[model samples]
Target chain A: MISRHGTPEHLPVRPFVALVALAVSVATFLWAGTAFAQASAAWPRVSPITIVINQSPWFGGFSKVVEAYEKETGNKVTLDVNPFAGSGEKQRNSVRSKEGQFDILVMNSAWLAEFYHGGFLTPLNTIDPAFKLDPQVMSYDDTGYWDAARKSNNAKTGVVYGVPINGNIQVLYYRADLYEKAGLKVPQTWEELAANAKALNSPPNVYGMVQRGARSASDISYDWMPYLHSHNGAIFKDEKAGDFTVTINSPEARQALDVYVNLAKTVGPPNPGSYGQAQVIQALLTGKAAHATPVIAAWPQLDDATKSAVVGKVNVAVLPHGPGGRTTPTLGHFIGGIPNNIPKDRQVAALAFLRWFQSYDAQVKYAQTGQPPIRSDVYAAAFMKTPEYRWSPAVLASLPNAKMMYTVPEGPQIASVLELRLNQAVLGEKTTADALNTAAAEIHDLMQKAGYKTARLPPLK
Target chain B: MRGTADRASAKAADRWRFYTLAPALAVYLLLALLPIVNLATMSVHDIHWQQGAARWTLVGMKHYAELPRDVLVRAGLANTALFALIAVTAEMLIGFALALFVSRIAVGRVLYRTIFLLPILLPGIVIGAIWKLMYNPDFGVINQLLHLLGLPGFDWLGSGSLAFLSVIIVDVWHWTPFVFLLLLAGLETLPQDIHEAAMLDGASAWQELRDVTIPMMVPILVMTLAFRLIVSFKVFDEVYLLTGGGPGTATEVLSFTIYRRFFTEDRMGYGSAISVIALFLLTLVIVLFMGMARRRMHAH
Candidate 1:
């Protein structure tokens, strides 16, 4: 079997195989080096992150924003939108199971404390090492947002839990035409509001004021907080207490309740107690109600010129003041935070997306699409110069006087308690004094049950 | 000696049969009994919801003890019971009458039957949304109709009593078709000669229905009633979508409470305890009704 060239045929094949093997090894090394070089050029391997949000109109254009983000960064993004009323429950369950299904939570500011208390939220600092919020994004109108939005860690250390994506406040939405027709100025006080409502009130045609008095507790109570605040009533005595005293059963609160009930019973919808935001929005847009309150984020749809009959007639103003002074609206800002248990990669992506979303440019885009901007600079930005959003100026003017609801570990739960009692008053099931007193008792019991060191103080004056 | 061998072989065959069923029994135990066992275990512990199955602090009988004291749980139970009792009775009576009328019709009987079954076929959530819109205060079709007739429109889901009644009416609307279809099937199978003979004997319509139809249809009636009871006890969707246990706990039922306690409150231990009790009660009621039915059938 020897070849004429002087070596065996099989012996020559061994050297040829060795040469091919050497070439393959060299090529593999070069290919790997090229891949590493490209990777070093940009952080390329960002896994998909899922964000859980409620189905609010403010989030209407979010899918497009997400698609844009995904296209720019080659990373997949998932949105898990739940109905607003049920989003809290879904988020709480996500917290309980510590599932990595949701990397980010776009939730109510009222819910931040509970999620933080339960160790469901990741500290904003932990989500990124090189994170710096625009100073404008940090506060507005001298509102120090770190304390405004809890400055604490799950281990009870110094940390920020969430960033405010929306600086939402309640505004009184009124039919300017109706006020003109009735020869009434925009009511500035509770007495004036009541009188105006009584004057314009007509059954089955144009009832006076509309109120959300439904019994879901949080929804109904959030709107009613401004009324109590305008009357100088506080739901709790202190925010930092382990167990706070309930001081809601004040003469001021009773008076607020009396006004609320009288408005609802005399001039409001036939079943005012059944009214939620949906009903209120319908009433306001159709010009069925002469006035409405706490018309939050809903102004977009209610004032859409093509969609609404009252487009040119609706005006925004401060909620009616009380004897205490001008009314202070309650804050239920939409806040965004990462959950504690998602992958590190997702944590980075979520933080990047959040910062990009709340950027001044993004805020302009959001403002143009009817989303309220969280930053003060967004107001001074060129977008705010033009009035695409009719409600922006009023929102900015109201910003200085806006106040955060109690940021306790059980704020929403306690909010519901306030809601139920206020609702009972609105429904005439309990006298104002009795309703507030009962709510105070229940609030005390709830605080005690949560293992708080509790006390109950009498209402101020 | 031969007979003894045969007997031993028969016993061995029986053992083989049971062995053949072992794989199915094992799967059933894993899929069904394991959750029940897990629920019982959870009910005993103070569950750290975040660390759910991985960790727990043992606190026996605490949740069970609290069940009786919880006002919401009691109200939910009462509402569920009242909903089942009233809804089932009305559905059965109306379903029976409709079934009889349709069974006797000589023209367009198929169309009538199809129309009656439409509500039952629709998704509960869709039905709920439709009802909620119809119950709206300002622009609901019902209110519009009333206004046209120069009558005042009532706030249907606004008042406590009215909210409860409206939810009941919706449930009845959704499920009465189920009763109608089941009873109609039974009516179709009934022999016609019996009715003809009753007529020839000069027995009035009422007499024929009371004496002959009642006795013959008892089994179907009982079975339909039993099915309706089981289904009604589990009502959640309509109540949830329509009233959400509001204007204030007016329509909150056991199932809705279970969801709220577990998911909303994150009280897994307490919620599981309630779930265990609910499962047991529902099972007992179904079994009791079925057992009585079986006994009555055998006696007949």
Candidate 2:
């Protein structure tokens, strides 16, 4: 067997067997070593979690943060992205299923009340007694807390159910270059804003302003909230104070309507009633709109060079106030909560992810993705000093004065009625007074039917 | 003895038939009848979601009582009726014309048929999104063409006056091919000698169409129109994607109302009530059309 090479063709049988055993032993040793390292280095007790989220302006940043979390924790995370309009149904179906399809549920503020009152979420404190939300995290009116007895979202008397993930609020976006060129001061009041809009308006080129007046998926009603609140008007007598008197047709509301409708008709793009969140943002990105008060989440897309034509040319400011009122931007935050229907293990894992999500370190990572982090301290992080995050200060300042559009479970239904009426007024289908009056009457009826002590309050003097 | 035996055998045959149909009938009852029954039950109650389960309170037809006063219901019913009327009429006329034109052509008929059928082949959602982009005021192809022609560009889906008509146009574009295909099949099956006799008798094309083609095609025409009308009543996607039943309540229809109440507003009992009413109306329309068709068949 060894004739060609002048060596033993094969080792002696015992030596050959020993050598084979040695090779196999080394192989097993290395394999066991790697496996032990993997088992030790991986998460102590990892459970794969799926999050149901809607496609939004902040989705890319959210996805990036999730990827970072997966890398750091060695846990599998799946993001189930759905259309913004369809996300509520997706979340509802998931929660209602026998075994929940999602571990994490991302809810918009408009629908948060329903979920909160429905008791779909397991309170965070119940999952882990030691886990507490970071003090610096913005509460967006303490929506994270739910008072089961009061059926209300309250910081003082409620338990922690969800954590704020997105600090979205409407802020004034304007073309800085145009403002500098025109020598116009930044508007601080509704009247001042109207004047500024009039000064810059030029049709088919650059409009003074654009408003989201479309009746699509809560767009028009949400866009009108700042106007209503800043004008000292309210949907109810006071939603948080247990007063459900319908006051949407108050004189202050009429004044707000006048301001809103006048601006849209006189200075906004043609057929402003058709403009939605997408259209308003598109108008700003294309430089066709000089100003708008879109949600702050859209700030990232405004400076994105690929999608925006007005990169670095736009600036953010606190939304202007109305006469006799203070700045009150509408809160539009997204919250993450664990659905009660999921397995306990999955809930614990989801809670772990949410706990880490609010940590100072994770907040910084999120801010680096050019999206607003829910934690207030992250606004002062080093990465936020970059030009890409120029809008952070304005958002931080605007958040303290932000108000929930409504705090009751009937908020969405009420907003639907207002959406139609407000859109009708914007399109001149009805007079502002008539529209508000009709909406007020309908809301009163709805509140009455919902077993509330509601009154159709007389219009204010 | 033979009669009695025949009667006994018939009873056995009837029992066999019932046994044979039992599975399919059960499936149909479970899938279709049960849901409608549940919907009817839900309509008479108040449903609230607590956690993952439903809590239903007996409301004693209160939701149905409120329907007559519901603003959206009134608006939806009016808009749905108008939409069905205008859209179905336009579709029938255009579909009839196209079918007649394609039937007369001696060559390239397949190409013509294929070209016309492309719109109906597309999914409704795709049709809705495409039409929405096309109707965009600033950069849409329709407005761009208007601008290029030195004509004023109007917001098609944005204007309160034009929004409903704009949706109707999209529906006509998407479904005219359906009517055309049905009518073409009917025309092909039509006896050719009658048309020849009419032509030989010095009847003009209009005369032939009116007296021979139309009268003879009544059954197919009724069937197509009824189908289109029923479908048009359920129009939701175009209204949703284009204008969202806006600039105001300009395009809100029955199905949109049901969706708003069911999905958006989360008023399940109220939504079920509206759905039951819609189903009843559709059922009535079906009955009326079936009766009309039977009468036409009997007359022929």
Reference contacts preserved by each model = 0.38, 0.76
Candidate 1 docking category? Answer: acceptable
lDDT of 1 by residue, A1-461 (tens): 88887678877677897999999999999997776666444435466788888887667756666776665456678889888757777777676664657888877766666665556767677667666566677342222223323433222334555666666778888888888887889788978988888888876777789888887636678777788878887777665543366777877777777777888888898868888877787788778888888545777777688768887788778788889666788876777878877778888878877867767766766666676777778877766666456577778777777766776656655775776678777877788888888888778877786666666656423
Which digits, one per residue and each the tens of the lDDT, describe model 2 over residues A1-461? 77564757675666777899999999999998776577446434469999999999888888998997887776789999999868889998878778889999999998898888787889898889997888999878888899989888888999999988888899999999999999999999989999999999999899998999898768888988999999999998878878898989999999999999999999998888899999999999999998999998898887888999999999999999899898889998899999989888999999988987898888888888788889998888777888878899888888888988888778878988998899989988889999999999899989999899889876433
Please give the lDDT score at residue A31 for candidate 2: 95
lDDT of 2 at B244: 80
lDDT tens per residue, model 1, B219-279: 9999899989999999989887898788777787999888767655556788899999999
For candidate 1 chain B, the 10 contiguous residues with the lowest summed lDDT are B46-55
| Local distance difference test, each candidate | 0.77, 0.89
For candidate 2, what's the TM-score of chain A, rounded to 2 decimals? 0.91
TM-score of chain B of each: 0.89, 0.91
Best model number under DockQ: 2
